[model samples]
Target: MTFAGFLGLALQTIKAPRDVARLLLSARLSSEALWTAFALVVVLNTLVFSATIALMPQDGFGLLGNPVAFMVVQAAALAGAVIAIASIGRAMGGKADLAQVAVLLIWLQSLRVLAQAALMIIGIASQPLAAGLALGVSVLGIWLSMNFIDEAHELGSLFKSAGVLILALMALAVGLSLLLSLLGVVPQGMNGYV
Candidate 1:
């Protein structure tokens, strides 16, 4: 397929989550659409992340100390986001193209990262309530972002879909972390064993 065809398929994938589900579940990737969705998402994510990072003060500190570590954490978060979106798509009986899934995940995860940076800059108390509030806002931002998709209409439905996707992804991440902990392979700075 020509690059234009790939671009068209990618655009369609972004416009319709149900179609993404159909394609992904069928395990069929048309030449033009095969990896286009994923690439688009990653590009979108990188743009968001770059903007966030740029806005953050260079001297600022976060959960992860070094810039490299922060980037790694962000990358993991992006992966988690993809898993969450994919899980939601699966639950909704739709297929999510891997590319589209990756894009969704990256975009969603970037919101959280941006929120964290904003909270840190504001010096918000890192209490449970504060954390919960921050998370809620971040989730809302993600939901709002989803509204840009042609297939998603109504703020309520968008919130529900984004919430389910985030929760599903979080669950999967927790489960994987637990398994790793149990095997004594949990990463450094991660407390608790499975």
Candidate 2:
């Protein structure tokens, strides 16, 4: 897609996320294709994240300091999120399959990469503005995810999708925290996330 087209879609994703979710779901992507795109999006996101971290002053964030490790963690986290959303949504009577969930998430992640790049550029001009943009983007990400889940699962209710998202995030946090602890990969200067 052209840059303008991408921007238009990005705007649509924020303005009418349910419709964007429907458009993505209607693509009828195969599981393999969805997974491959998911992987690619994860990698792209990692690259942007790593680059952003590299350019910033050395913070105490050791986990994000290692690109390879960060990439691995990112991939695992995203895959877990996909599974959690798909399963939890299904248990909640959502009709979306794993592939449908994957597509929406992958598209969201792709947009995240774009947002990250924009933040990086904006950070160069004004740190405060960049911080504000990051906060706004984070909020929008949550909102978009809720809408996407609702659309993908045909839940027809943002409240149900919000519940699924909350449960999925809680599960992910617990699971990742445990796995990270087991692997002795605690972030520097921070207690274990429980």
Q: Report residue 113 deviation for candidate 2 (angstroms).
A: 0.4
Tens-place lDDT per residue, model 1, 1-194, is 57586556545644654464344434444546534644444444455445545654343344334444444454555566556556665566544544555544433443444555555545334455656777777656554445432132222455556665556667768865654455444355545553
Which candidate number maximizes lDDT? Answer: 2
Per-model TM values vs. the true structure: 0.43, 0.92
| lDDT measured at residue 61 in model 2 versus the true structure, 0 to 100 | 56
Question: Tens-digit lDDT track for model 2 on 88-178?
Answer: 9999999998888888898898899999999998997898999999999999999999999999888989999999999999999998888
Whole-model lDDT, model 1: 0.50
Misplaced by over 4 Å in model 2 are 190-194
Candidate 1 is scored at a TM of: 0.43
Leading candidate by TM-score: 2
